[model samples]
Target: MGNCIICGKPVDGLVCESHQEDVVFEFDGNSPSQLTPDRYYRGTVDGYADFGVFVDIGDHVTGLLHRSELDRRLESLDWEPGDTVYVQVLDVRDNGNVDLGWSIRQTERDFRGKLIDAPDGEHHPEDVETNDDEGSASAGAAADEAEPSGADDETSSADDATPSADATVPNGRGAHAATAEPEPVEESLAEETEGGLNRTTVDSIGEQVGSVVHLEGEITSVRQTSGPTIFELRDETATVECAAFEEAGVRAYPDVDVDDVVALQGEVERRHGELQVETEALEILAGDERDAVADRLEEALEQEAAPTSVDLLADHDAVSAVRDELVDAATVIRRAVMETRPIIVRHSATADGYVAGAAIERAVLPLVREKHTRDDAEYHYFERRPLDGRVYDMDAATGDVTSMLEARDRHGEQLPLVVLVDAGSTAESADGYELLAHYGAESLVIDDSRTDEEIVDAVAVAVAPSLAGADVDDVTSSALAANVAAHVNDDVRDDLVHLPAVSYWEDTPEAYADLATEAGYDETGVSERREAVALEAYYQSYKDKRELVTDLLFGDGEATRAQDGNLAAHVSGQFRDKLETELETATENLESRDAGGAEVTVLDTAAFTHRFDFPTTDLLLDELHRRRDAAFTLGVDEDELRVRASDGIDVRELGEAIREAVPDGGVHVVGGRDGHVEFLQGEREAVREAALEALEELTA
Candidate 1:
């Protein structure tokens, strides 16, 4: 019998049954079966799994602290591998697996005393340190030989590494410090032993120039230079470009590709203000080594890519209806950025699409610059290509596939995440979406158009308010894009607050208009930006124009600065002049007729307006429709039919009626958020007559 450490009570060992909970046990046993249940044990984090954390209680014994046993969120714990933590031994199963539970007492100071739970017997923890110290003296000497003779600094560093004893126990019951494997060095740390070099992180190699160092990380990207194969290695701290050379214009480490967890030994060199590794040896890690690095990066990326709690910029009901869907889309986009997968935005060629796509670009560019070590990473990682129309057709999909496949073959980039903004919510784009999917690419759609139910299965995330049975007429695609952008990156939330309003043409939401006004843009400012983007969208309808678009929609209005808002006004003047001239001609060429009792005015857009000019066919049509005095307005291009009314037009019903009348014309609703009907050019006259008859019957 003995007395408890905390109380004056009798017990079989050092602590009584009631006082057992007051003590922390240092587990030195070789088997999980030897651990006592319901006692707190000191454990080192071995590695992380999706379900739980593996904690090493002894040299051979490991316990799983399931995520359910954690006091807080598993990802929020901030515990890294090899970190010493405290837990309770909940049970030791017959299969030799140990189950651990959360312990309220994490620090040694919280316990009354520390006991060593050995296989033979239990004893005071202080007694084992004398033996541990003598056992580590040989490793201490080995470490001293590998490093400079700063004996005190070397010993303290060695002391810090002592807790994480090798789980393999290769030395057979060795000292903790002697069996401990050092983690990858975080900063300017250099170590050379008689056996080989120690591990150094990519971030630490900046100062270790001209010296051979070892690195352990996942390869985020790879590029073939003329003289060498450049591999971008990313560790917890940062990514460095590693160049491995077999011969000039030849592939080095041919089997190694992106996302491979690797251990690379190379000499660090400074090239063009960036560090590059000239590889000496490379090994693809497997088993525990790969799992450890993968887990670390997975956790890091998950934390970085997790969406911030950003409330919707405005209280618009349509946007509020699908808030969760917005979050899902944003999370997908942010994760793609973190994983170094390129983002290809395919948006409709319009003022709304430009603003929608630009909002995401503005939020994501800064993150791309921050995540990648290379200066040109933003341009390479993010791209925005405008669609000729609102549909993601085969031509666009084929072009995207060719470029992405070529990149994967040549530079070793992962397949991109295609973001369809203001488009691709209908059956028209399903073939294109499926083509991308076959090539292992995922897509996210944020459109305000009426969604086809079948499209839900085709995309990774779909954020269409119409899916939730809400009217999306007043909800511009830019509102959805900007909201998604805010969630993707919270740092640019201030820059995005006003963008939702700038996308609106006529019925600017009072709340959104107020938001724009607060962000230094009034009604006139919003109009000018909208007009400028509309004008520019026509010029290069296929390019991102990142900087120029950023300046126009999100310009800082300081008068001294000569770009941004100043530039918006300059371009908008041209827009106003060109639009006025086109509108005047379009109005002069209008022909009116009585259909039933309603007056329908028709403008032959192909004959009167410039085929390729500042005011695009759609823009000219919208302006004429807005200025029309008649009850209904129709604009006819070569093979296209456009319709507009004060209230919404049911293009589907009208198209059905017209198609019945002109079955030989091959007339169909091919495009537009509301509706745009198209026909075979050779049968334009018959299609137009059928559309006029359909309008008369519908109005009757």
Candidate 2:
């Protein structure tokens, strides 16, 4: 939708009757250049200068003109600011200041200059070329008299006899000349057209008189400045005066009721004052519709009337209640896990500061333990020890060495043990399931449902029998046995979505109150009002941060801070760091930031990788990571990666190979047309391979 220049509302047409009288000027279409460095001036040229002419526009503003930029004829003209010049608005800076641009004395010849030697419309030049008459001597004498002499002797004598132009200049004439005639040729070039119609009433379409037209907005003011009472209605559009109270025969006096939520309809008419609807035929809507309108108004007011943060924190209980609700389901699963015996626990840290394995170990283990032990089941625990390396601890829980350590130390062999995982563990998937299945161990994965858990579980369980065999070797063969023993449990499936990854500061209201009180705001009824305000604020901030991080990658910058000076730099750094933390944990597909500084991303908590949603948080982060890697490839220092990530997503790793790849400094990689990656430095194959590797664990 195209926006109206005056009110910024989207409109269908630019010059409809509703906007005919609106004050507007074209920025780029009519003028060759409109941007200005000079301020608005109703001034004249002070004097001509080498680079430009300086015009003293009254007080202190000076308009400039370069000698090369001006017409040569203006060099002899004495002008100053008091002489008006139409300066165009160019740049409006952050400091609420403006700059203007101006030009001096463009003539009609300028317009004709674009045409090749077009004749002047007066016909004098044509006559000069075609005249022929009388005796030869007489004709030659006549032609001699008509011709202009190269010297200006006669014109000079006439000018000497007249008053000086500057001394007798008319009041405001110089100002008018400078401003109005800045582009003299433009006026002649414009083709004027006669307007065909004037504004007509809506009633002309045969609408009933006094029928309600359904308008909603605030009443700005009620005044009787011009004999008749007028009420100004201000909507999203510009304000319009409604003079319903001025009309006779109407008891409806809405103007007297300030800020009233009214539903009114009346006949459109022109009064002595302004355009208004006659109140005599007005109707004030009643009943359910009126109530609904009032309700909507109330909601709007509430949204606008949120209280300070300090007040919210002071009433911590309410905030705490909401937090409790958000995590209740996850807590139930955590307790269930601890009770499950011989629960296979696996753990790994997400790049974001979250522990992923604990969810499975904490929630489902207890239930398994209790259910098995209650049935008098002989439960034997086994720990899988990889012979090749000590990296197997990547799948261990916090305190699992109590009984298993002694058995492993003494016998170097043990029965198949249940694997226990921490909340948000890295070993939940990405071949972890396949490895576990090969060892013939009963495997259970704790995972956020939004990620890989379900798929891995189903695949691993399909080979359950081979997994349970005594001689489990070569991961693929035992996979079928592990699948048969471990059917996907409905209980476990239902528990994933409710897993609590988020913590609510139940005591937030109090914290907010303390913060607000320290800031010195009006604390009246601050506690109750603060909670409502803070919750709404937090959500909004979450949304905003998400958008901002996304923009940093795409270069859209719609949600980014203004790219001016150090403020942008500082903000970018702070935002990148925060988003990095979240991205590392979730490996989310996308992320965004809200004004409240929350980092919301939708990636798995264990791996720092996820599918990239175009124009989403994940995409932005991926782009930044790609850039940082590129920079490293170009010989840029890893520390600078911090700054580059500030351009969008956070970078986690900087390998020596990447550093070497960037010959000059930092390697810049760009997404390729073929759904692959290429180094902007042109090392296509190497960069594509690296990007593919980074994306290996991400799901489609």
Candidate 3:
């Protein structure tokens, strides 16, 4: 038997199962079957095919690296015959065909170690034990691992048998890894006690660098990277990352996952300014011990997840109506942060949506930092995604499902708590909510749009006050979300003070306007920020843009007011210029007619204006409707129609009437409260005329 070259663990070959991925292997095997699947190997370019590139593994084995598996297009490959490349063996067919996959790292330096897969390369532990010359923290670990399993014959106490003999460890970190001050790994080797290993909380390990410690906690998550399996462990104190390398890109402790209570012993090390545990051994806890750890964690989470007290930013009847529901929404978000379940906020890509998302983001980010021990946890724990409209349709849900599934399957992340802000209240999002429900994922809807009651049962939390007979018009989504954000953390209550005001483009409430003034933001400041956000929200509507958004809105830095004003003026200027251009074009082509004493104006958006431009059709439509003195205004596009009424009208009822009048018009209502309708492109002209006739009927 040989031993692992790095860890000095006994194995049948040069490397153990855990360290196999750490070492890059040069395939010298005789046949395709001899090539181990899922392991990286060095290969030579034999030639190229229409479907794939032919790569030679050693002398006799040649495999096909299919173009579909490549990161870039097959034709863009810069490889020539006989040139060396690294690849992963994927499969070996019974007929002698080999399937190879792409390896992101092409050079030997990208790997931690190297090994030759030759028959005569078997190595003993002593022969390959790292000498003191290499400056590795694990240098002495290899020697200690080599000692006979009958180690009980030597040391009486576990602490006395500690590896590294309390010697100073030199830094051997790469550019990606952080090097802690050189220090002897503390000699207090954790010993098994009645409660398991000597319990050490994650928060306490910051000052204990280079120490071998025992930690017992619930595994919040596990991420498989190119190098190691990072198990995020959470005690009552805080969550931390414990890396256990089994194989490069392979799961370390496969049985353990999110929420599993486990005990792990490892050396604490610093990586990229973050404290991480280099796991030596880890196992799932069971029975009484597991129950105790689990209970402790649960108790702490419940306490941390609840808000102390809450007061609304203003006394508006619309927001006050759903006060209890807003508190519940706040609790859901807080609980998600404490349990390390990610929070994904999907909102309409509008000024109102941006304000709502920013409020929650500002509130929850601080809690994430306090709870999660990882430095980069804030980015992973909270994300804001902007959807095109207020409906979370199947198209949006499909993207969400694909992302969450990959994270759960590949990284062992707990299914996120998907929060819909300023969106997903309508029954149009039913299929999307049901799809998430099918996977046991929880969701919360915080929209104020008119909705069918069926959506209340579809999600975990529905914070739509309109369902409770509250007026939807008086409440902007940002007003509801700002209340929820206030309840999340009292510390950021001041930060959310202006968000509700910023969300309202017109008719700012007296209380909110007063609050904005007290917060040093005049009416112009709020409008500048609102217009600025609307412009930015349109361009890259998909990305979170966390840092930039935070700066534009909250201004976490000291020079924030001046900087925020400067940015707002610059971006909002572009917003005004684009919007005015569209409004000018739309005004020239508008057609108006009187029906039953009501004036109805129509703009042919597809022909008269930029159908898909900086100011989206709906946005431009809103401006035109506001400028007109008509009782109702309609924006008709190639395949869709949008309506605005002085007194809000029901688009669903209008769509039904239109469909009855023109049976082949293909008019279908998209959103009831928003007065959005869709039709077949071929039936646009008929649908437009039918819509006008239907409006005349409604007026009559």
Candidate 4:
């Protein structure tokens, strides 16, 4: 008999029968049947398959790990063949097939106790028993008969009498009382007291830097660097990296791995501006203690995962239709922040798109800081990329996939949640969405554009006004994104009140305009910010200039020239000058043509307008359409054709008419809700004729 390693109770094995499952076994058996069911075993990856992976438990037994048992997609697994892994034996079939279950704890140190399971029997690390019990008895009898008659004999006799010395004298009675085993019990009690008294949460370790602390948490990830093995431990409150080093490139604490609940005693230290712990001792918490730690973390996470209730900023038809989805988007973003998943916000490169993306970024940054213990969590957890066009194209998705894959390989990061704001509503983005889905990355699109029904199926959530039977033109993407941002974090709602007003170039909604005015932004201020953001957005079309954008949109209000020259005021003047100059030149060179019964204004943009200027083609067309009174305004450049019209013209329908008229024009809608189309430059004459003919039919 021996004392249990955990509770210190006397048992036949090193661990008591009650805690057998908590002990990890190294299988030395020759057959599958010799392995115990519901017990974890250290195994090696044999190979992978489409359905599952084959793991070699020992020399003679192998198990199959089904894909359904994995926590994530099989492709995301960073395991290599022959790598050591941990698995639980679920069953051994009559056909010699061993069924295995996934074990989150991958290393030996993750278990409370480790044992060697042989074909003959089980053996504990501290136990002296063997399969040859009869041979051992014979040898012991021979040794007893050959007892020494010198100093060695005297020493052996003294060692044998030590157990009797600790026993209490029997009472003066006919029956002797049983001797109590007090040392093991006392030691167990002392350990329990010490563990409980010194236990600290990971979040609290920040205040205890330079002091020894005991922390109980689950290891989220384990990485072996050139110098040390870093284990990232996460408790209910926060996560910290614990470094354990024995030698360079050598495995330290070889039994510890990802997803193991352990009680670690270490000295908290600051390493390169981040909180780290130099682990002095680590113990795997098992049985009830492990369950208690897991339960506490789950409870805390449950509370954090609960979505905040949405507070509607304004009552409108568009708002009512997408209110629920807005709340859902907010909830998803908030949950991503808590779970430490990166959020990639993709938006169109427009004034409205920038505002929408900026609002979400502003709302999410604080949550990132609040949720994570790392100072760089904002950069790691959130990113904003502006799309050159109003579609989440294959090119954009491919770039995201490449970067995210690199991050995952280098940093062991979870796949990011792709949040599509002001973009990704059309069928054109279906292929891109499919690529993201294949990698099992969650995607959500929030837009007020006319979305294709197919796009709804492509993404996890689609918050488009047209899907709810609301008019697509009645709402802007910025307005929808602003609402979602407000709900994502209500504390930043006041800062976002002016966003919707800046999104609209022409007919700004009365409700949103009033909200912006109440938030201290007048008509001039809102327009100035809009133009400034648009100008800046063009320069770095891909990067999200967080601080510069914040200054432009939410900066302190001052006169045009004040104590500090306002970026918005300065940029907005440049925006007005460039736009006015372009409008004047375009109007001077404009030619009016009668097509059927409608007046059409044709501007040869390539000849009269600046191609690479402050005002983009889309923005110039918008201004020209607003100022020119025509049935249809067509802007033609060397590479593409842009059309803007009155309320009656459906650009999508008109594009189809043009495609039918000029079969070789290669016409298709490219500019999202703005209703711009692209055509082959070689067939420009054919495209122009088709557009004029289509306009005539529509006017008629």
**Top-TM-score candidate index:** 3
Quote the positional error of residue 199 for candidate 3 in Å.
Answer: 1.9
What TM-score do all the candidates reach, one by one? 0.70, 0.20, 0.76, 0.69
The residue-level lDDT of candidate 3 at 301 comes to: 81
Ranking by TM-score: 3, 1, 4, 2
Return the lDDT, model 1, position 284.
Answer: 77
> Model 3, 177-264: lDDT tens per residue?
2223334333322235444457788889998888777888888787766666778998888888887765456677678788788878
The residue-by-residue lDDT of candidate 4 on 91-210, one tens digit each, is 999999999987645656445457777664455533324324444543223323332221133344322322221121112100011133222223332276475546788778889877
Better of 3 and 4 by TM-score: 3
Q: Between prediction 1 and prediction 2, which has the larger TM-score?
A: 1
Root-mean-square deviation of candidate 3: 10.0
Clashing pairs in 3: 18-246, 21-248
Better of 1 and 4 by lDDT: 1
Q: What digit string (tens of lDDT, one per residue) describes model 1 on residues 1-700?
A: 4445444354555667764765689887787878999888899999999899999997788999999776344654667888888888999999998999976445575354677777755565544564477665433233223322111342444223332221111111112213454354343212232247777866578689878788888887777643356788887666777776553335787888898998887667665455667675667778887898789888987787778775888898999999999889888898888788899999988999999999889888888787776656777788999998888888999999999998887777889999999988888889999999999999989999988887899999999999999988899999999999999888899899889888988888899999999988888888989998999988978876767787788766563246543787888889999999999988899998777877788889889999878798788877887777777788888898888866667777777887898887778886534668888898888877787888877788
Model 2 clash number: 114
Runs of candidate 2 with Cα error greater than 4 angstroms are 1-341, 351-356, 361-435, 448-685, 688-700
